[model samples]
Target chain A: MAYSIPTRQSTADIIFAQLRKEIMSLDLLPGTKLSEAEVAAKFGVSRQPVREALNLLSSESLVEIQPQKATRVGRFSMRRIEAARFARRAIEIEVLKNASENWSDVYAPSFARCLDAQRRAVAEQDTHSFQTLDEEFHALMADVAKAPFAFQQIKSHKSYIDRICALSLKDAAEMAVLVRDHEALLTHLAAQDATGAEAALRIHLSRIEKTIAAVHHANAEYFND
Target chain B: MAYSIPTRQSTADIIFAQLRKEIMSLDLLPGTKLSEAEVAAKFGVSRQPVREALNLLSSESLVEIQPQKATRVGRFSMRRIEAARFARRAIEIEVLKNASENWSDVYAPSFARCLDAQRRAVAEQDTHSFQTLDEEFHALMADVAKAPFAFQQIKSHKSYIDRICALSLKDAAEMAVLVRDHEALLTHLAAQDATGAEAALRIHLSRIEKTIAAVHHANAEYFND
Candidate 1:
């Protein structure tokens, strides 16, 4: 067994992480005003840390700060979501292309474990863990491609798409579909079929369009574009 | 002519921009110690703004800040450079493939104009302007691909690679070679030859390897890996 040392997080970092989670989870609804004083009081800290946290969230575009006015959770924009999807697809295609060529038997066990864990998450109706497993699955693919930084870049774009995903009404169904996509993607990679892998990955990613449409229909008021 | 309004910059933003330019241009050599008080005095500002500037640079990996110890310019790492290149190449290749399919006569005149300006920059041996033109050439290709955001992402990674390019000794000759490569890429795009365009881009970006080798020989002390 290995023990990992816990890294320190600044008060601001802690505040930012909590606020970001709330925002992404849609607990802090879009257009909801964020007050530094209230956040500071809730966190039992000074307003300085709250302001810093807000600034960090603003950089992520999760919050909008109007210098003299007020800060608020960001509203969904189709334009930003589309742009994020475009960049994500481009990088993932490249990663998949490489992964198909570099597929090794060494990674099979890890893939199997992740898939089994994903299935368990689906059965247990654990959407959050399922999301984590989905990310790990894609991340494992990046490892297979030997381009971890490529996934780092993908994660940056994913936050935008995730906002829409969070608005989704059916968690278990979506998780199951996503699991199936992963299974298909892995099968294509197992066969070392670059073309088939690319096609599978595309089909996997294109599911987001249906997600966006469904979420928009269900939560039209939350979107601005 | 259309008039565009200039956006305001905060004091910290200005300091960050100037320091980034100096570091990228090799005026501030890698691993050079940076003092908050000294930089404040140099920029005719207070330590607060200087600290903010250093924080911004730290985010870009252009500087390293050790809390309560010292801050210094980031040293070159072949690992980081290669990672940046891999991401850049993947995105650029996707952009080129799109451009090859979406080529239009309307963009031809712009390409010709950019190529001519690049040539003029080479004739005058103006490395700064030449670098700007090179970015513009790439940006235009992204526009042709109808994926301007892709280029935005590429520019983020290009800063990492620019450090090495700044170290190259042959300014004019390098500019000439890059300009020629841009011309070849444009020719391939005009012919709607995706394979040729991708090949040309690979050849163009591969020049960085030679630049890296030459710079490593000249400035071995500035590198870490």
Candidate 2:
């Protein structure tokens, strides 16, 4: 289901959203300490809102809050990272299968358009835009399959993967590979080859597995076994 | 990943967990209004903690919050229910496949024990226990497959489905059917029949689809299109 439009967000929500983005983008790197008073001052809000925001983030494992101890950005747990990958792969493969079965001329243009945007994003070295487009490309498959809700699980699990990917984004060559994989996946989908589409998707996702070690080594302090 | 053991919980966390259980169990039916002040009074705490709890629940879509308006238990959106079902089925089927392939003598007894618990729960007419056992049975499969993380997605999605199931617990006969399904699934797993296990799991999940129309009709006010 889609997020309900908030007519007016509470101060806590505003802070939570901002902090969540920062944490996910690694702007607030893992192991960074967060204090309610300091964060509240930075946001020009009271500590109450900041506390609430941290509490929410803690629930999602984005931050670790210890009783009577300083709160810190959560360490990257490999267990969680692996779990996220497994969940995303399972859900996306099913979504691709459905999209393949439902392939139609009507779905072709949108898929083509997303790939075009991906190429532009890569050429322009716009990692942020490319990341957004990457998500949209997969999400579009769910939409085309008439099961847009499948993207919720995909997005949820992707948060963990995205953080790791953010650390690996320096490899621009990977962007080209991702786009190529997407194109191959789309080709299979257009051909109504469910099995081929799943194979292509598996290859696309496996890139993350291959890069995990390098990313972890580069950001050693951020990870936990 | 497993939840970190909390050394101590704040007042807010305690209240939040309790309220979350109540909401998911359908004790707080859809459309029931919740007030920060009233909840605080009931819990003998300040309004701050209650407000925080509501915010957390809102994030989970367990409650609907509006500025300057009453927060209410979230309506059962058919779309969300369908999505949760789709996600859980996909993940569980995959987990069953793995469990079948990895079937060891050690895994058999646990499945058999869980099924025994299910039978006892049904015979005793303990719907709550039956529900818990039902979850455990599926979660056990993921554990057996060494894909324990899959249970996280399954449990997340099951929250939405459980609320719907709570309303249909009156049909004691359905519990028996669920146990039978589990028995057949365990038989397939014991035989190391991945395909058979997946087929049995599909049949088990499909029961929910068959009940949706009847449950929605019976609890008309709790659902939304």
Candidate 3:
């Protein structure tokens, strides 16, 4: 008890979070079966907490739990991925446009830090860590726009995108290209070039969408028809 | 089996659909405890169907489930509603702007129908039906944009917003102003007035924010603090 999993977080919270981290990091690949009994035994709890955790994850579209069926990591949906990408691209470009128009000097350092983390993630060849930082980088853009929650829709969409990326094991060069896109976006934002930022960000997301679809089709077995 | 419900749509579907309708209409108010035993009895089924129904609702953020405690209709949250509205506005306006750029003569009829329904809703003093039509009206914008999923996100967020509105009960006059705004938006979209439509839509969402906040304060008990 000297070193607990931090104070006051319920077993459900702990279970939900641990499972989410695994899902996001691709430690739990799409379509991976989530056995309630196994999860309960591993977490030193009963089936109820595991069920609740799975329910919460299901809300995030991270898991699929069916009545009288085994719980599993969620299936891939090309339509949904495409749909999420469209929404993310549309909204992100808008946010970039806003930040480009209203770039306060305050967000500059965090933006730089985000870029650097991606760089390090690449150098270390850590796709897992790189993906997390990639999310943070997008979040930093929302911060620059002073509309942090504006990215919530995109964030949800991004996880779906992440699932595809995880299954594909995208090339490091593509990751480098993404970093470059972020770099270009930062430059345009720094210069307050609203139209230019929008254009650049649009191109970036379009490329991601193309690559994502290719990845999905390449592993059609992993996807839901 | 004189008449059959599709297996894809089962008892769980019936219970979920019925409960969702009640919640949306505010016939089942926020904080109202949902006893599976009672709900099952009313539906002339066993508790298993009701339990699955509640789980489905819980995943959709329409019901609250507490471990070892009773489940209930979730309370409205000003924070969640405002957050939802922000997202709806952000996404819907972008789709509206897109629609203006590519005027779809096909969806014009749908848009007209939404307006016609709104008029009926007001005349009949059916706020609940009005809200459903309001959703269709916005979904029409996405149809016009060829970005149907954007409407999907808006629809997901609308449930949260509806819970707040059920508390506020904004007057019929308020509904009229929104209808007028929709008409203006429709006019602008028809004319392909991107800038004007975006401006009007922004103002429309801003008014919703103010009115919804006023209602939140006036009836604090209806929401989850």
True contacts kept of each: 0.41, 0.69, 0.38
Q: What ordering of candidates by TM-score runs from best to worst? A: 2, 1, 3
Interface RMSD, all candidates in order, equals: 1.8, 1.5, 3.1
The digit string of per-residue lDDT tens for model 2 on B107-199 reads 778888888888888899998898789889888889988998899889998878878877775567989998999999988998999879878
The pairs that clash in candidate 1 are: none
Docking quality of model 1: it rates as medium
TM for candidate 1 is 0.90
Q: Could you estimate the TM-score for every candidate?
A: 0.90, 0.92, 0.81
What TM-score number comes out for model 3? 0.81
List per-prediction Cα lDDT, in the order shown. Answer: 0.86, 0.87, 0.81
Off by over 4 Å in 1: A1-7, A217-224, B1-7, B217-221
Candidate 1 C-alpha lDDT tens digits along B1-108: 858556567787799889999998889999999999999999899987787677768777889887668999988887788778887888898899889999999999
Highest TM-score: which candidate?
A: 2
Give the range where candidate 3 chain A is weakest over 10 consecutive residues by summed lDDT: A1-10
**Candidate 2 clash pair list:** none
Q: Candidate 2 residues A39-116, lDDT tens each?
A: 999989899989989989988899998778799999998988888888888888789878888889888888889999
- Model 2 global lDDT (CA atoms, 0 to 1): 0.87
Please name the candidate that would achieve the greatest DockQ relative to the true structure.
2
lDDT of 1 by residue, A1-225 (tens): 757445467787799899999998889999999989989999999987787678667767888886567888988877778778887887898899889999999999999999999999999998888889889999999999999888888898897888778776657888798899999999999999887988888888998888798888888787786
lDDT of 3 by residue, B1-225 (tens): 457544466786789899999988789987789988999989899987788679778766678987577898987765667567667776787798789988967778888888999998988888878878888888888888878888888787876776666656667888888899999999999999987998998888888677677877887777786
Error of 2 at A195 (Å): 2.3
